[model samples]
Target: MHPRLIAPGALAAASVLLAIPASAASVSPGAPGIGDPYYPAYGNGGYDVSHYDLRLKYQPATDALEGTATILARTTQDLSRFDLDFLLDVDEVRVNGARAAFAASGEHELEITPRTPLAQGTAVTVVVRYHGIPSSKQAYGFTSWHRTPDGGVGANEPEAAWWWFPGNDHPRDKATFDVSVQVPDGTQALSNGTLQSTVSRLGWTRYSWRSDKPQATYLATLAVGRFDLTTGTTESGIPVVNAYSKDLGAQAGAARASIERTGEIADWLSGYFGPYPFNALGGYVPNTTTGYALETQTRPYYSPRQFANGSNTSVVVHELAHQWYGDLVSVAGWKDIWINEGFARYAQWLWSEHEGEGTAQELADYAYASRPADDPFWTVRPGDPGPENQFHIAVYDRGALALQALRNEIGDDAFFTVLKGWPQRYAHGNATVADFRGYAEEVSGASLGTLFDTWLFQPSKPTASAARTVSLVPAEAAPARPRSWQRIAATNGVHEH
Candidate 1:
């Protein structure tokens, strides 16, 4: 997801408190959240989901969504009850083929008490029937369910599924998904992974898409509308599917121009982040008013505004690099967002080098000097920015700065090794910021504690001499350098995701 903001200096912060844990036996209720320090109520505990079989029907005309979600999971503890993060009005819930009592506990949680206690390590299947206008549902003051002209889209960062489907909504609970959305015959339903079937019957069409690899729930997406889908394969034979809403008007051309290069960009990114991690490669431009682009697993989501200026492969690179950093290896907690944003933004810098627009060193130096020492950009500690500042520009740019600093401190050989090997080591799993730093240190045999502290943890800008000493570039303030992150900041028209 795009950080979207140039955080102001007055963006107040006093402190930031920042996991998932299971319970023991005793037939107790599952914890309301999956133990994330930043969001205590984000995900549910006591069970790990393996897959989600979502059979949905969406009516764009009414902005109504009706669905039955079949969740297959394993109980982590003996449980008298469990919770699913959801918001829609549920008609009924069944656990293990028996009727289960359920109710809405909060804005986004559905508390379910099964007819029988679930035993630890036992496989369980939960079926939920629900109906609602997803766009009408809001939590935490916003809605990720976007009501488009012809259809609605379910896509956002940190939290998305609550408005569309129900499950353990946090990134820590990665699961494969089979999403079958039945829409009116004239419209198309698009989602993650390979298209299993496009079956039409009696004025209704069902689009079945499946993600073979485990994916974070937020990364699972939905788009139901009239679309111009471009399908093919990458240079390395990975399947690619690009979608542009027919209503995109002027931005359609630019969106296509950038999104069509998904295959080519994935090919380029594979060199640095190891082989392409997923079964498919592509993105979608859905004429959304959200004003941001999100790295939604195999197919990233792009706002029409992202291409409002022209074809921007830098944004494309930013999202595609996330195929490795964010989608493949998700953060252990929300506080570890740098593992996603910083790593992907750094990929944009690499693309600048590849395109001869600017070198990474030049961009890093430019980014460092673009902000004065007292700018809130420096105040946002990328390592553990509070929830409010999690998606600040500093998390993206300063996070990339931390990576470049690591590269310089550890030297090119070890840095590149760490870059290629980090995802492979934690592929399809959750990792933290400290985990990444440790991996870099393990590869470089260099104690980088102070360097990370200065760049990521410290709330003040490092001295200009550090830049000169590391990347051999004079850290002059605001030179007439090549187009750098200041340009990206201008182009990154994202909402408060």
Candidate 2:
């Protein structure tokens, strides 16, 4: 069972303080977990993180990692102690430059108690020092940190960020980051944002990276390996950086050729989705691992096999589109994952239509008719498909169908208004499913209760509408599978890294 929030004893202390005229209420401990319906233990409450300063050193020979994380945060409520979602052993913890007592509870909770009770709205600095081998345990069908041939990759999603560094490891609590990693000579380290500086001494090099924009923990990525790093700028002057592993010898040329078109794609997307949300743009092509690609903040991660298969352009467009949909405006909870996947899927259709491959209407109509009436894919609601089925086909295909249906109901003008304005309004923030419905209504000046009910909430296949075409052909003519792009979309392209 997912963990629930453990309420503090502060109410009783407040009552005592109110009864006694001369006494003040004592601060109490914060809640151990944030109250999320899907994964309740994902984030901690009573504090807001502003920035994370992480310094890490990895030894590939032993698979050992030593890290010191200094987190800057502010309290939201009166607190004597608080918890961070951490899954490894901690050697020491300091709160506001003072030694603090800590204990490990449950699977991923680092409970820390400070020497003095903290007041509400007070700023605090926490430093944690730990040394351990990062876990490669699979959570949502992908390992959090995987040890590659030469080095390791840190690609965490949902509940796996705790396996590497300690923080309020959830998407709702976004923060800036300053990450630095030390590796052996002749190797490279890559992370989010811009490369700040690099210093080498005694056969060891430390590469520093900084992200000025607010980012969620799931979007945080760290890749350590021998890479051929390349840098350039987009037409609009956005910085572009690409890193390809030396192991991808022959396929590296095709990967670089496809990566060069990133600027043109971003320029096209900016015309429809407002401005690009990040300071940098590019991706990394590492040796094959998860058989998928991930939109890790500014720089996405891809497998060399994707390029070799001739799906490079479509995959690049899908991941780069996520910079606006998933990375910029995140979701409030795991249940609202369609807000991310759906938008990226629709972006793929939009790119296809622009390239003269197929229109979104045609794709949506095909998907609606391809499935049999009794298929479970259409029965599951994309809005809340539970934890285990979060990345199912319903979330991608059905979610995109919902958006396309909206585009048909509301004219192209209002629909495009929503596409552009929604991201700008909630830039670098989190939104829920209800928030999206309300925004669409507000922008279109029409009520869409029935549309959302049929597409998002109902538990069966939708009735045939004008958007769905009727077909009487052999099943082989129009296979029930998703289109080429949709096939890649099934990988839930955000988490695997």
Candidate 3:
């Protein structure tokens, strides 16, 4: 399972071009919605997903998978039925270990209809078995395994988990994850949080990982190869494990330094935002050609090409920031993704401050000068990150700019106060931009309507107009860069509120 939040463009562009073996599973009980099918709106609050047991045999030679999955979930609402969305490749399913029906109405989702009424807080377990060549495409969620130029294997499944398993495949449905994968004898496997154990049976190795925190569907990850593994503990007792590829040479002290720094950052964030939400914190530096890193729960997956060298502190800070912003407090849906990227990006800026680097102003000024004035928060259209721009720039960079603006409007103490409070208030849950804005207004004791409107709602930067009329004292000289007598009008094509 490769769980990463995907941009809408990538999600919209997928099709069944690659060949997939057809399955003869029983006909589904009913049809599901054409749009993201897995995350159904359960009216009553508090969803409890108890456990997930996946039985799969993975063949790396041809990238084929034969597996059975049993999932148990509970809801606080008194409901007669429940439905789940999984990848379309599933061949058979049983609710509570009995033959149950399912339907594939969407590209990446299989609608699961249970046979019996599931009452409030009633535990449910689903068993599924099937076989197919899981798609390598990111569109339908489940991405099959692929090896890099080095022998190490890495996979990414953002917005789509259907390439591997079956479930409610959306970020909103927070659940505890339990995975068991059967791989070849020599290969090692790594995933989201911590490894429980590895049992050897015949030529297959079943690796188990369990996450105690509430995790979104897209944050699940899997890496497999002849990995060189090392284990250590942080100063605060969090486990630190490293998975290095054989072709990547020996692990160095710098890796440990970064991990220690990760612990420090986590402590700082915990005090500021909330406690470390998960049981473990670690990740592997996979050999890759891409520069972007995937923050997969406690163990974030970093690419060696980007993070191994000391030059990629921003990337490291960005992913580490996600542990609180994106992982602990998540976006309710795809449209509000800025809450994830924006907060994480600002966390990087705060780290820069802690490191005694350039002030937040210098960072914002540099970012503002680099991007064109026409576009602000990356969306020419809703769900479009930007016109040919990675969500990083629009979502992360400009999103950071928005927080800087808020910081300027509110004093430093109150600003930090809001930052530290949000993750705990919304942990294991979902939030919107409005939710944050309300929280900020409550903490800051000021109106942020004009600031949020100029920075967030509009795709244009605020123009800092010089104070036209300056009052100079006749006797005493004014301090250098004195405060402006009048507020400057920001006319960057946005009507000021």
Best by TM-score: 1
Q: How does model 1 score by TM-score?
A: 0.93
* Highest lDDT against the true fold, candidate: 1
The residue pairs found clashing in candidate 2 are none
lDDT of 2 by residue, 311-388 (tens): 467777778888988889998888988888888888878887887666777677677777887998877898888887
Provide the lDDT at 64 for model 1.
Answer: 89
lDDT of 1 by residue, 423-486 (tens): 9989999999899989998999999999999999998888877766666554444545766555
Ranking by lDDT: 1, 2, 3
Candidate 3 lDDT at 375 equals 55
My TM-score estimates for the predictions, one after another, are 0.93, 0.89, 0.76
The local distance difference test score of each candidate is 0.89, 0.81, 0.61
- When sorted by TM-score, best at the front, the candidate numbers are 1, 2, 3
The model with the greater lDDT, 2 or 3, is 2
Q: Give the TM-score of candidate 2.
A: 0.89
Q: In candidate 1, how many Å is residue 68 off?
A: 0.9
How well does candidate 3 match the true structure in TM-score terms? 0.76
